[model samples]
Target: MSKNPLTTILEANIFNGTNYNDWLRNLKIVLDFENQTYVLDMYLPRALPEESTHEERLTFEKWHKDNRKVCSIVLASMTNDIQKQYDRHDDVRPIMPRMSQIYAVPDQHIRYAATKVFFDTKMIERSSVQEHGVKMLYLVEKLGDLKADLAKEMYIDVILQSLHPSFDSFIVNYNMNGFDKDLHELINILVQCKATIEKSAQSVLVREASTSKAKGKGARCWRRNKGKTESTTASAQSAPVAPLGMGKGKRKAVRQSLIPKDVCINCHEKGHWKRECPKLLPNQAVKLISANGLQVVNRSRRLRQTVLKFSNGRVVATLV
Candidate 1:
């Protein structure tokens, strides 16, 4: 068959195939955008093995090596582009908002960490002039239960003693009493109460504070008596101390632990005689006070807390 010279030449070129694998190996040298500025992504396939295999199988190890080379090139190019953009800046870029210098401290004078405090003052009438052969002395007498309004003052005195290790002789409020009770023992009990309340209250405060602050609100509950809210306590101060049989036991005292004198054999709780126990009575539902002081009706659930406080600084607490 007669053929044109150009067609014959093209057929001859197709027949003579080039070795692509060899071409890749020769281009193995790394190329930088500007001398050592940055590198552009490039890949080069490795030469084939000398031996032949009946089953052609691709392996992840080989694929990964090629992928790594390609990634490094891309990364280098990105780095170069960013550096160029930064160099072209004509005006000074504003600094990022100074990283917040977070701290656990608050910047306020009246703020307190943990510890209940109170201030107290009282007026007493006394003879100012000394009669003949009489030695009249001026004394500042301690009287009255520290009132709520003066709590801040009392807090200062306590805080001072706590801050000054040398003032160890200063007695905390709970240890001071007119009665002959052992002051040391009373102080220990008070310490335990303070510690417990401090820990729990701080946790609650921290959480609430964080949430409130996040929502652009004040961190404080703003309630002076945040934890105290009961009617009985409010009435206790004015309510004439009921006779010995009437005053409920105060659990703050460490000497005695409170427990039900009589357990229903059916259910256990104080303020109830076994016979009067609702659990023992057939078909009679039992209504009991919960930890929150809410009345819940149940036969199996036991009462959680024994102490009850009133708003008036009176507490009805039980020792466990």
Candidate 2:
């Protein structure tokens, strides 16, 4: 026996209370493939009476058989729950329409829902502008299917309004130019705008990352320099001083080594030599030298004093 064509083909989607439209659409494809779609269209001839002519009788009988086969195919595709509701109807025409009415949403309700979805949809941060625009278009198509009166401008507005703030500039320019664009044109513009925005955002992120890295490096360098300065200061304060009789060369070398490289030995300030230091007056310079504990070896002088040693080997006397 030949395999049943219905069994050979992939089974149509079984109606499950809902999804009547999708199920019906798939069922039509199957029926069309099997050359049994005539039953749904009510084109199949009815059975003839006994008094009919021989040719007429044969034609009616063949159509009757085809009609019954188509009806069985439709019934087989339905789930048990949906099948029970329309199984009493032997003709596919009445059965299909009745099932559609029972399961499909009313036209008005679909339109209302589509309108609400179209207007209420807003772009979220997680979704790109292209994704948001696509969703808007899908809702517009749904409305169009219901014969809803939606103008091109209205749809463009809907899509534009649903966009995230990232497209603010585009929106402003679009409104300023009063550009009249159809759905396709608007979608293309939105796609390009989204690409530019994403690219700009990526560039900004890269710059910020590089800037942050540079700042971090600078902070680390500053911290390292500060630490070296503090350590040098602490070591200078803690270092044991050599006896007074130590040669000027050895004493000067030890003092210079203990002091921070940036600090001046004469004025104890940074960034200038003692000779050119404006802050160090002649008296202040003498006091600074006396504070260093350098005593002058003068047996003839009754008063004890300290001497300031310059880098050029010049010595100046100051009373302690």
Winning model by TM-score: 2
- Cα-based TM-score, every candidate: 0.14, 0.63
Residue-wise C-alpha lDDT for candidate 2, range 126-159, written one tens digit per residue: 5776677778878888888899997888888878
Model 1, CA-based lDDT: 0.34
User: In model 1, how many backbone clashes occur?
Assistant: 10
lDDT of 2 at 144: 88
**In terms of lDDT, which candidate is strongest?**
2
Minimal lDDT window, size 10, model 1: 132-141
lDDT of 2 at 198: 83
List, residue by residue over 64-109, the lDDT tens digit for candidate 1.
3444443333232223433243333221111001101221122231
Could you give the C-alpha RMSD of every candidate to the true structure, in order shown? Answer: 42.2, 14.5
Every candidate's lDDT: 0.34, 0.76
